[model samples]
Target: MDKLGNDELATILKWVQDPHDRKSLSLVCKRWCKIEGFNKVSLRIFEPNSLHKFLPRFPNLLKFESSETISDTQMIFLAKTCPKIQRLNLKFDTFDASNDFGDHGLFALSKGCSNLRSVILRKRRGIRDGGVASLAKFLKNLVNLDLGFCKMITDEALETIGKMGSLRSLNLQGCCLISDLGLSFLANGILGKSLVYLVLAECDRISDVGVMELMNLRCLEELNVAECGPKVTDIGGKAIAAMESLKRLNLSWLINVSDDTVFALAEISKNLVSLDLTGCEMITGDGIRAFASHKCLCEIVLTSVNKFNANDLEELVFGCKSLEFVRVDARLRSWIPVTEQGNIFRPNCWISWRL
Candidate 1:
């Protein structure tokens, strides 16, 4: 095995997908370590100390992820080493405000990794507008940008993102400071025509005006505006209804959305597959009834819905034959396996209880 050519060694390494297994393989021999390094294109670093040791091994790395505590110096080192990197994710699930990685590190990355197309910086508290501005200026090829849970980002960061004309997936979820003004920048820019997936969940400042801007994204396939209350209303629903390409939508916790908006969404999105109306108290059985006409709908979640009872759900089951999964108030009545036409569920049907 050690005497094999690079192509043969790469073929053997490609069979090992799990990181732990790959590490075990690398430890077998020096030749195996070199083969593993040459074959690897993506890596997730859990320890900051391994940066210098591992980076040199994988010279052709394209994607890098680090959820551990990493400083600006380490980030700069990564960029300097992997100039061909296309994706960089530096999300920290447990935020530490004292982390020193900030604009300086990101600036270095933007300068060195010019081919960067996807960047996910979720929960990186130190990152702000200045760091992102550099990316917008240099990373013209960016396609997917996820800044979810980045409390530091505001309208200024969004302004820079709008200029990235090639962007297709944008996730700004939990960026509380961003208002309709930020969305307007995107809607009016070149990204409006290119973006396919947009997530604005918990951006409460955005209203119907901001949502209306999304109508210009004709290629949009998935939209999540969940929990954007008091501002997002039926007007936003109207705008969403106009997007014919939308397949999956989450309107959960939008208290103002009633049967009217729900019905309109059901009628318009003919190809809709998954719909979540969780905590949408205003929607009645009438709106859910309209979903029966949906030819492709497979999954429906109606948790905490007030109006629908046992009988209404039965009607829905009978009407929509394509439905493979349905989640409702299971506590309302006894749920017995129905042997209706033959089986109301597919072989893989599963029931998940919220409580």
Candidate 2:
């Protein structure tokens, strides 16, 4: 082992896929430990304050994650230590109100690590528009960004995100400040051409006017506008139905949407595979029956939707040959007989009875 060169050691280490075996090999000698650190590509730190003590050992790291409360100084140290990082996950619990990590740290990371492709800053209250602007300015190849529950982010942050041509998936769930104007920015520019997945759940400020603007996103595949307030009626729902590339859609709790929207989705959204209409009280049994002949729909969720009956569900299960999963209220168990339920189970579909 002492006769083998550094290159030979690295080659042998690459074949040792088991992490335990790799750790054992590193303990053999000081030189083996150094070689293992050089080849390391990913690291997750539980205590970020002690980052400077041992971070330099892994200079070739490509991915980094931390859920602990991190400070700006520590983040800067991490950026300077691992410049090759491509994915950064800093998601922490929403209850942490510390202002230690903010735009200064984000700017340093974005400037130092230009190769970042995926960055998840969910529930980071310190991160405002300035940090997001820095990302748009520096990280040209960034693909997936999750800014969920970042209450400080407004239309100004979205304006910068609109110019990110390489970004594909974006989550703005719980961002209450963004309105119709921000949605318009996302619909018009390079973002429309690149983005395929978008989540706007719990963003109460966005209404039908904002949703109508998203019709320009021709490449969009999955969209979630669940619990986005009552302003999103059949008008917005109809606009969503017009998008041909959509496969998965979540419109849960949009109480204003009636049978018109359901019928439209059943007729137009030819590739839709999953549909969630949970808590949509306006839609009746007729609306639930609209997707009976849908060729591509395989999963449907109707929990808390009291307007539909067991007969409507039976029709949907029997008529839709591609149906595989159906979720409905537990109250329907008494409506159908045991023999009839057995007949309904003949097809390769599972029914989830939820209370």
Candidate 3:
């Protein structure tokens, strides 16, 4: 362990002694202060100076999750100090202003933390599209990034994000500013790269054209366009079918999908394990039958509004032997047969399948 690289040594700090002791150690000596252990420095509280003092010491830090209160000033301080930071998880109450996160703090972090892999800015308000552009400008190594419930971000942010080549998994659910225009960034441009998971649930503005553009990423594995408004149609479904790596799709509450989408899915991705078409009123028994052909499906949700008939239900009941959870009209039901015939959940039940 003593012969490890500076990167490796910093990682070892997480396993050292108590949390309080770790904090004290950073202040003990200049050698210890510069010891690549920023990520290991657990935080019960984060103030501007303390974070500023703690961050520069570690160069190998990967993830930082702040459970306590953190101000924008402190966030910028921390980001400025940590250049190699990979995953930044800021779930603080004070991270945003009254209406948005306007790239001040985020810009500082992205500028310094060029190696960022995943970032989750959950529930922080007042962030706009410009901040997204800032993120794309700096954090080039992002794999998974989520800006959930941020009202100010627009399609411009999406465009910037799509242009970043390293992006694999992205979640922009409830971001009301996005529209189909962002697809121009995700079009045939980055098709050769590997983008596995993408979620645009409840964007309201994004439609089939965006989904169609996304299909070009041949390595894409899962997609969740659930709760999107009437903008999404079967055209998106056809595009999804062409993605060979797609194993799961969530179109819940879309309310527009019909049999055509299901048929395309059935013909292409035979490896599907989870399919949610809940609240899709246009779906019928034929669609369900088409979905049933996905023998690997284990979790299915068909909720709200009338679409399918009795025959479809019966076939679905008989076919999906691997089903573990099924939702119907907001009600949760466990459908996996509990027989001794090999405990139903197929292979890996606990692992996050895809979407």
User: What C-alpha RMSD separates each model from the true structure?
Assistant: 3.3, 1.2, 5.8
Residue 108 in model 3: lDDT:
77
* Residue 201 accuracy (lDDT) in model 1: 95
- Candidate number with the higher lDDT (1 or 2): 2
Clashing pairs in 3: 36-58, 99-126, 100-126, 100-127, 101-126, 101-127
Q: For this target, which candidate reaches the highest lDDT against the unseen true structure?
A: 2
| lDDT value, residue 17 of candidate 3 | 75
What is the C-alpha local distance difference test score of each model?
0.83, 0.92, 0.69
Candidate 3: lDDT of 102? 48
Which residue pairs overlap in candidate 2's backbone? none
Candidate 1: where are CA atoms >4 Å away? 1-35, 334-354
Clash count, predicted structure 3: 6
State residue 277's C-alpha deviation in candidate 1, in Å: 0.4
Which digits, one per residue and each the tens of the lDDT, describe model 1 over residues 278-316? Answer: 999988888888877678888889888878765566666
How well is each residue in 1-355 modelled by candidate 3, as lDDT tens digits?
4466767766667677776777687677665666725455333335444765545555455667764545567767677666666777865465445433347777877887787888888666656777788888877677788888877877677767767788787777888877777755655545227578877788888888777777677777788888888878888877777788878899887766777888887778777777888778888878777755566777777766466644466566556666556555422223323352233234433222122
- Deviation from truth (RMSD, Å), model 2: 1.2
TM-score of 2: 0.97
Q: In candidate 2, where is summed lDDT lowest over 10 consecutive residues? A: 91-100
Pick the winner on lDDT between candidates 1 and 3.
1
Question: How would you order the candidates by TM-score, starting with the best?
Answer: 2, 1, 3
